[model samples]
Target: MIFYHFGKYILLLKSVFRRPEKASIYKREIFKEMVDIGLGSLGIISIISIFIGAVTTVQTAFQLVSDLIPKSIIGSITRDSTILELSPTICSLVLAGKIGSSIASQIGTMRVTEQIDALEIMGINAPGYLILPKLLAGVMMIPLLVIIAIFLSITGGYFAGVASGAVTAAEYIQGLTTDFIPFTVTVAMVKAVIFAFIITTVSSYQGFYTDGGALEVGQSSTKAVVISCISILVADYIIAQLLL
Candidate 1:
């Protein structure tokens, strides 16, 4: 069954990547999806990022109880942690729940309502028309969101470290600025893109193959979120191992 679903998912991806019937329409749809996936997700990302960073900073400071250790190390730990793992991974997981479920439900509804059938009747490339824009948008916007999340998380760490008496402002700033690796950012971006692709394509696959009616649609949505999250975690570990 797993092999069957995997084969079907691969076939669906091929269909999704096929040439679109109209470039202009696809472009318009792409922009709409970008806004929906990016802008719509900003609020929750912001909240989650800030708190995570703050907590990481506090916890890291708590653990480094040695008087011999510099307080600035807290900032370095928080910065690296956020960039390498927290921002991209956590934010992607949250988005898997938000955007994945929405995509599944939307496509599942269309499938059940015969809208997808109607598209076929009209000679449209239904998968290309329905899923391609989402794929493109996810590829583009998710990285941008990760960037924002990284920045916000660091900022939050700074404030929390200072306010909580965990680290001084000057020490935190020095730590954040010092010994930073450019490659970490590259790895994060790579993870962001891969996670984005996983979320959009997996959700769309679940939705496109949805069977039955309302109850089934709900099931598909739930499955999409669960699968997307699992895929994100697996991809995260693989990327980390390969890159770092």
Candidate 2:
């Protein structure tokens, strides 16, 4: 059963990367789904980004002052962490939770209902049609989401710094700029793209081959989230190592 399910997943992945000779009619559809996943999921990403930045700033300020560390570098620390790790890795996990589960359940349900099979009968490349567009969308939108995450997080951190009396708003902003690196954004963008692809592709695969009935759909959804979460963490470490 495991291999039966995984075999399809591997094949779908191969199909996704297949050359022009292997490409099918489903690529555009996958792109549209990607856009939907990205645009639709923006709210959660925005809310989380703001709060995470605020909390990190608050905590960093408290610790720096409380621990008698250099106060001026607080903003730099916050900025670096947000751009390098927090924004990309954390946001990917969020997407895995919000969008990944949705992809799994929706597709899994469609599978159980025989819609995927019908598409195949109609000569559609079911995997390409269902999975590719979503995968592409995820790959595309994740970087945009990460960029937003960075901006919101940094802004929130600045506010928190002033509100908490750890640093003046201007000082906090100044500290952030001193340590700014353009490549950090590129690093984050790369990570977001990879993470997006991982979550979307894995979730879609789980959904694509879901079996049994509604129970199986539920199981697939749970598995999709679990696997995606784990994959995100693993991929983060791997990608970070590769990039850094």
Candidate 3:
């Protein structure tokens, strides 16, 4: 069954990447999806990122309970943690719940209602028309969101550290500026793109293959989120191993 589903998923991806019948229409759809996936997600992502960074800083400070360690190291630790793991992985997980479920439900509903059948009857490339826009949008916007997350997280750490009297402002600033590896950002972006692809495509696959009615739609949505999350975690580990 897993092999069957995997084969189907691969075929669906091939369909999704097929050339569109109307480039202009696909472009419009891509833009709309970008707005929905990126701008619509900003508030939750921002709030979560800030708090995650703050907690990381506080926890790291709590752990390094020795006079031998410099307080500035807290900033460095927070910065690297946020960039390497917290921002990309956690935000992607959050988005797997939000955007992944939405995609699955939307597509599942369409499938159950025979909207996809109508598209096929009309000679439209249904997968390309529906999923391609989302794929492109995810690829474009998710990395940008991760970049924003990285900045906000570091800022949050700074505020939390200073406010908690855990580190001085000068120390935090110096730590943030010191010994920063530019390649980490590259790794983060790679992870973000892969995670975004997993979220969008896995959800779409669940939705596209959905059977039955409303209850089934909800089931498909749930499955989409679950599968997307699992895929994201697996991909995260693989990317870390290969890239880092």
C-alpha RMSD for every candidate? 0.5, 2.6, 0.6
Candidate 2 stretches with Cα past 4 Å from truth are 1-8, 18-31, 66-69
Error of 2 at 225 (Å): 0.6
| Stretch of 10 with least lDDT, candidate 3 | 170-179
lDDT of each: 0.96, 0.83, 0.95
List residue ranges in candidate 1 displaced over 4 A.
Answer: none
How well is each residue in 1-244 modelled by candidate 1, as lDDT tens digits? 9999999999999999898999999999999999999999999999999999999999999999899999989989999999999999999999999999999999999999999999999999999999999999999999999999999999999999999999999999999999999999999999999999999999999999998999999999999999999999999999999999
TM, every model = 0.99, 0.90, 0.99
Model 2, range 95-141, lDDT digits (tens) per residue? 89888889999999999999999977987677766777787778888
The whole-model C-alpha lDDT of candidate 1 against the native structure comes to: 0.96
Between 1 and 2, whose TM-score is larger?
1
Write down the worst ten-residue block by lDDT for model 2: 18-27
Clashing pairs in 3: none
